[model samples]
Target: MPAPKISVIVPAFNHEAYVVDALNSVLGQSLGDLELIVIDDASRDGTWDAIQSIRDPRLRALRHEHNRGAHATLNEGLGLASGDFLAILNSDDAFHPERLARMVAALDSDARLAFSGVDFIDSDSQPAPGHERALDYASACARCAGQPPASWLLTSNLAITTSNFVFPRSLFQRIGGFSELRYTHDWEWALRASTDTPPLWLPEPLVRYRVHPSNTLAEDDVWRHIHENAYIQTLALGGSLDGLDAEGACTALLHNTSLPPLATLCFGIAARRLADDTALRALTRPGPDGWFLRQLAQATGLNDGVFRSARQLADQQSALGAQQCLIDERWATIQQMSGIIAERDAALQAQAELIEERAQAMAHMSAEIAHRDEAITAQGRLLEERFAAMEEMGREIHARDQIVSEQSAVIARLMATPWNRLRRFVTKLRH
Candidate 1:
């Protein structure tokens, strides 16, 4: 087939969960004349297998035998492009179905533009939190009519990713591929490209930029992030600000004010003394100027840099105060919770003491009852002995009555007989 309209290069690392979706987003675009070149950067996960599962004729899957960084992988993918316009998508990020169509139309509107970009969505394809800052910058760019796109880019990396790129392949070959910076290579390239051909910003969220724990900028080393960013920004300042009149230079310089003191000084130094790259590089290194630079960098952030614009500095201070207030409120809430827990524990302790006292009382009552039961048993035995003695007395009285009756009958018999009366009289005398 002939060369495609666009060549989208996807550099996959460990995005097995997301690579297929990223590829599908490209292949299933409404603008269907594009070729999808996916390079798996020797991902340890199932990213390579996921790429292989895609069977579209427009998709070509490539793999790296060994691991390489994102910069090298992107450069290699760009080298194999066979289309008029070149684009890049990170393996973990996806595009809207209509993104390419809209971006292509934007690129066609201005021949002088290097590339076109849109706002981004978060991982779940929702509006990314704090994305308003990026939108505000875009809105500011729009409001600042006739401002050099290069100068505005110098302010911040509003495009934010190579995934946002949809530029001419020729420009990629001319300006360069990507830099070797670990963190901000996409930004470095954007700065490099904007200086020559300017970038076009589309205000719609056409791409899903995954903000996650494993993001590429997820570096715990504070120094490296600051150091690498300062390095690129300083170098960017050197030649990128040339040919600007007083207004343009001032615009660019003002843009650099929001940067740290090290980067701010670099912009000033590079503007005046950019002949030797070594001198600009030496400003950030540890040497005669190191202590002062460290102090300023460590001092109050941009607050120490009186060179910064007053409005932006005040804004930073205001933001810092707000953050401190929030921290105080959160601390107060935690203390309140702790107090409640302590009170609950005290109440529980009191209940336990009461239960122990009740148990002791019950034990004492049980002992008294046992003693009373023993005395009652002894009294019952005495009553039983008395009843037995009364029964024996009753038997003795009955026997005496029987004997008296028998004696009376014998006397009656004797009286009835001729000698009975004489016998009775004899018995009475004997008694």
Candidate 2:
């Protein structure tokens, strides 16, 4: 059988709810000459059943005898891809209808271009405002124009998601397909593919990444492992982590909910170790040292709230090594103070309890005290009722405040319309 122009490999596992969207996304692309290969990795759920329901001749669904991981499934799909070009689409991720059309054109125009990619949709499947720059070619080209070739996209949105990229089959083969490594495998693949050849960059969030409840990174344990694995891969690649600060930021974001204080500290140390590797000295020169410091601070639990604590400790310790040395000191102080405070406070609380008991004993003999106690109890009940009412009132007030704020913003916007139009006209006249 003749190979198609492009082969899109999709690895699906228990993504029944989203598989159809993924399949329809590929099948509905503007580009033709596309072959869709879906490898169902022994999904016990309705994932394979969903694939069976799709009747497109171009799509070939392969099933495994038993469940394998995403890496194994992806490699299996790779073996089945016969097109001159290769692309990967996760089961939960979809592409904009024109994604393939644009990337394929870029690859065809430049024989040396090993790959091309677009931006990914945020977790909500909506284009993220912060990363929207990757969705426009003009902006991407402009960003890359004056930068050194090696420094091209070193820090920012240079790499594209696996679902968003398309690469030549030869290049994919030469790189030996996807590595077994998890988390940063896509990033590693992107780096390797762009090693000798410059990959075309398409700025656009054509790939819609689904952030569902069952995401691997959602669990604390999984996220930590993924971040550590990514850092390990960065070290293994001989890639200078002068970008460690940026990576640390991404790490913090990825595992913010899951990572404990200690885990974050460890991740920061691991990141610093990566940055300090001798092999990466060339990549991280003098200019990025400040970034390293900032990253080190973040990793050491020095958030804005904790910065003062860090600063206070720095007065006693060296400002440079203060963060690391302060951890033990801080822990010791916290423990010692907590124990001492607990013991003293417990004794004082007991004394206060005895005094209260004596007061109650004396109060029991006085009829006036008994009447006052009843009045106080009634007041307490009234306070409890008032508190509940106030809570409800607070919620209503908050809702009303939000509505008022939104209305005010709308009014402010409308009020500026004439001024904005006048300014625009004046600007045009001046030009």
Candidate 3:
């Protein structure tokens, strides 16, 4: 019964869709001398079933009867892990094939380096945009080359997330494992661990971190994360900040403006707790602190003139943003009104064209009616002339008939007269 070279811890909750892929990535690693420890934190989904389906001897699956948080699950896995080195793989995230091999090699080569670099991937298991390559660990370290390890870590968590961390198991015992936190446990652990031994930077994308809607570091949890970060900073600093060399630490932190706002605020809190007025002044003297930092300052009773100035600046920025929003709305309304006016103009133009067409049609119809009226008048005159000619013919016919009747009567009278006897006597004598 020998311990594996590496112990991979997976804190799965509701990652049934991706848990298989995550498990496969770990079990299929090129370096086979590793044990996979998956703790199901009472997932309501089929994540537990998926974990059980994997039939590997090196795989150790644990289940919580109740829904324990991720931190508890991790702590349990750490306690049960039987390996020389430790690695964490979120159930929703996966690793490249060579991730375990590469990270182990990096840790083996350097005793002081706690972990290697990481790469981000999207939900589709593809490399995230702007994260095509592994993080520029060398450049980051080079930026803090001469600074103390504590100062560098206080400024930034060189290893971005737990998924990117693969350290010697002994280091966990030295640092007392992860703290009990709802959020920011990984960050807190990194802050503490890196302060002791700086992490080694492996400039290759070994892990595939999945970013999706269900990610724990969602925007809505920002405040919670900030609160936890401040708490962790306080714990790290203990009751006093004397050991941190507040002046030097503040200078180092301020030099890197790229540090997250939360980390900077944490430094401010530490300085305020220590009553290092000079450090506090230096930290907040950069014109204006952001709204969150200002709130932190006020909470810690560090609201001096510097804080007031920052509050005023924040108020001004907020007012400007409101004014800009109003301007945009007004501009949009004007554009909409302009569009409406243009549509009305077009409609009016169409109506005008229609009116013109109707007028032309009416004019043509009137001309046609006039032409028809003239034709009717000419026909009426022709009918009157024809009637007059017929009347004249009728009169002529009547006169002729009267004349014939009179002529017939006269012929009859003459025949009955004496001519008849005289003519007849003469004719007989001649015959």
Candidate 4:
């Protein structure tokens, strides 16, 4: 039998609900010269049975006794693939009828191009919003003007999903194979595989990336993904990830909640380092960061509230730090004022002691003055008593002198008369 033009690898796990749809989408492709290889990685569900039910000459269903993982299963499929071109379609996703034809035509036109473009769809098989435009070949060529293909891919993955990738088998062999990682294996593989060969961009939505409840990318897993991406970036920077098989590296970077700025910077740098000119030009084009964030939010099917919560958390941290600084400053000021008050108290205590000593000296002087004033008052009272006794003696003397004068005058008058002289002699005998 002639070898098929393309070999489609479908890695099936616990996708019993969607595996049939995935297989039907590939079988219904307009391009019939293709081989389908579905690998069941020890699914606990009926996925193996569903894959077994399909009986087509091109269909090759393989199973693992013990679950290895998606990456291992993909490696197995790659080892068995015998087509000119290789493609991957996740069990949970489906492809459009013209996907293979369109991608094959694009690759055939340019032997240098490694892969083609991708499209997205919801779990209900409905067309994803904002991605309705078909791939514009001319515009894409013009945009990547003057830039190498490998450099363009390093900047941004034009092949948005692994399901959208349809590259030459030769390119896959040259770049080695997919790296074994739990999360971001596709991204890592793309980075390594497209380092030299640039991929083609098919703007049309060729693959329906179902956004369902069972999607592997959960909110809690974002940190792990970011860390894994950082590690991948490190490997790329050190040139160690070129063809290295990074098995279980995914387990090391887990349990993180948010993407740190450093990690984000590293991721950007890694992308630029790996980007071709086309990717760099597309990235340099004028656009808002919000638009990119919104695209991510839409692709992840997460609500805007999650981002708001992160913003609020960051604002709260900033406010808390500012408040802590103010508190520290106020505490220092209080300490300074307490020291000043202590010094003032010490000076006031010294002044109070001096004033007390002066008061004691003044009290001693007042006591001495009071004792001298008491002695002077006693002397003044004694002099007043003596002066009163002298006044009484003087009064008695004057009365006696006046009596003598009267007696003398009477005697003179008696001498003039004998009768007066006899009366005077009788008064003297009576005295």
Each prediction's TM-score versus the true structure: 0.61, 0.51, 0.58, 0.53
Give all candidates' CA lDDT scores. 0.73, 0.64, 0.71, 0.66
Tens-digit lDDT string for candidate 3 (201-227)? 665767777778787766564444444
Winner by lDDT between candidate 4 and candidate 2: 4
**Per-candidate total of colliding backbone pairs:** 2, 5, 0, 13
Q: Which of the predicted structures, 1 or 2, would earn the higher lDDT when compared with the native?
A: 1
List CA RMSD, all candidates.
9.2, 38.3, 9.9, 19.7
Error of 2 at 256 (Å): 16
Determine the C-alpha RMSD for candidate 1 after optimal superposition of all C-alphas: 9.2
Identify the runs in model 2 with alpha carbons over 4 angstroms from their true place.
Answer: 109-149, 152-160, 222-431
Q: Rank the candidates by TM-score, best first.
A: 1, 3, 4, 2
Q: Tens-digit lDDT track for model 1 on 1-431?
A: 69998899999999988888889999989999899999998899999999998898999889999988899999999999998888899997888899888888888845333334454556665666466544555655564445655565655666767888888887787887786667777877777677656678776768777766677766574444554556656655654564467677555545643355444554465547566644544443456644334456566665334534434567879999999999999999989999998999999999999999999999999899999999998888988898898899889999999999999999777669968677778999999
TM-score of 2: 0.51
Of 3 and 4, the candidate ranking higher by lDDT = 3
lDDT of 2 by residue, 1-431 (tens): 88888899999888888899899999999887899999998898999999999999999989998887776787788888899888888888887888887777777845433334444445456655455333333354455555443334332334444666677787767766665544545655665666665557655556776655676545554332434333433432344333335555344233222122333344445556565533332222223453332355567767522222222334435754677778879999999999999999999999999999988877776878789889999999999999999999999999999999999999889868988879879999999
Ranking 1 against 3 by lDDT, winner: 1
Q: In model 1, which regions exceed 4 Å deviation?
A: 109-119, 129-148, 239-258, 266-431
- For model 4 the local lDDT of residue 25 reads 94
Better of 1 and 4 by lDDT: 1
